[model samples]
Target: MATRAELTEIFGAEGVISLPRSEATAAGLSEDDARVLCDVGFPAELPVIFSLDVPGDPSAFSLVPVDTGADITKVLCLGGPSGNSEMRYCLDMEDGYVILLTLGRQPAAEIINSTVDAFVEFLYRYGLRLKHIASADDRQADEYTKQLRQYLAERDPQAFAEEDTWWNMIFDRLLGKEF
Candidate 1:
């Protein structure tokens, strides 16, 4: 698992900011989780945020508050909106597993990765996917996919498979397939 310092090195100071401990505490995060959040902070920008109803409206993406008061057990909102939002990402407080909460879909909270480290890796891979989709040339995309596969395999093989499956489902849904 990558440490906070390692993540900072990977993401850079501009990309990753340390969250205030007070804010993390107020958000009801556990000590270790709070440390992780406080250390690496949240992603400055999520590369992907597409609305199901409106595809081109940039206003569709916004951060939603993670309600710790909600009835769901042992889950913390990592980023993104809830309710009307098509997808919301979360973390399982108990084990640091990352989960995807898809609204209006069966089996709502899909476990995407086994740990926060793996989850961060997933974010990096997802960003690559977005870039690949946008770029005209396939060379960069192929290289990125190759590197990401190696990173995931080295970090956690199981998470590599799970993230690939989850991203496939997510991409399918984004492309107009019903969840």
Candidate 2:
């Protein structure tokens, strides 16, 4: 569950902003999808590692929309870097899966989590782990990274189902920079 208090704690009170139901509906979102966006809303502007930014509008659903093979509206782009080939975070309304539309001509959209709640939780968890990483030893850092990866996989196996997922890319970058 992505309760208000939990989100506030993760992305300060000022940072959190609920997605508008009207915008979601206008974007061809389902009732359940609209409800989820309105209820567990995300930060309209997040510049963190697990980031999804909609600076122009408040949690706007209007951006570079993509067709994820299935249908023209299967993947709904929330926000990210501009352009069609840029990194865009999206939502698979019907499946309730959060997508990290990566850059490349290949399969651009990859599942970030099975649900938006898990995605929020992952962002919170990753941030916490990053804050405390400096205090940990080399061995501790490796263990913590492994634990976080395992936790994320357990939370949503579909997100980590592929070897070259967005989650894997994040972990790889983390290793390259930190460990």
Q: Which has the greatest TM-score?
A: 2
Per-prediction CA RMSD (Å) = 6.8, 4.1
* Inter-residue clash pairs, candidate 1: none
Estimate the lDDT of model 1.
0.55
lDDT of 2 by residue, 1-179 (tens): 55667667766787666677777777777776676667776654444453355334323365444665665655666565333335667777768787776655664666778877777667667765765676998778878998988988898787778777778877777666432
Q: After superposition, how far is residue 14 of candidate 1 from its true place, in Å?
A: 5.2
lDDT of 1 at 76: 59
TM-score of every prediction relative to native: 0.60, 0.74
Give model 1 RMSD, 1 decimal: 6.8
Candidate 1 residues lying further than 4 Å off, grouped into runs, are 1-18, 49-72, 81-84, 105-107, 125-137, 162-164, 168-179
User: lDDT of each model, Cα atoms only?
Assistant: 0.55, 0.66
Candidate 2 clashes: the total is 0
User: Which residue runs of candidate 2 sit more than 4 Å off their true CA positions?
Assistant: 44-48, 54-60, 63-65, 68-70, 81-85, 102-107, 177-179
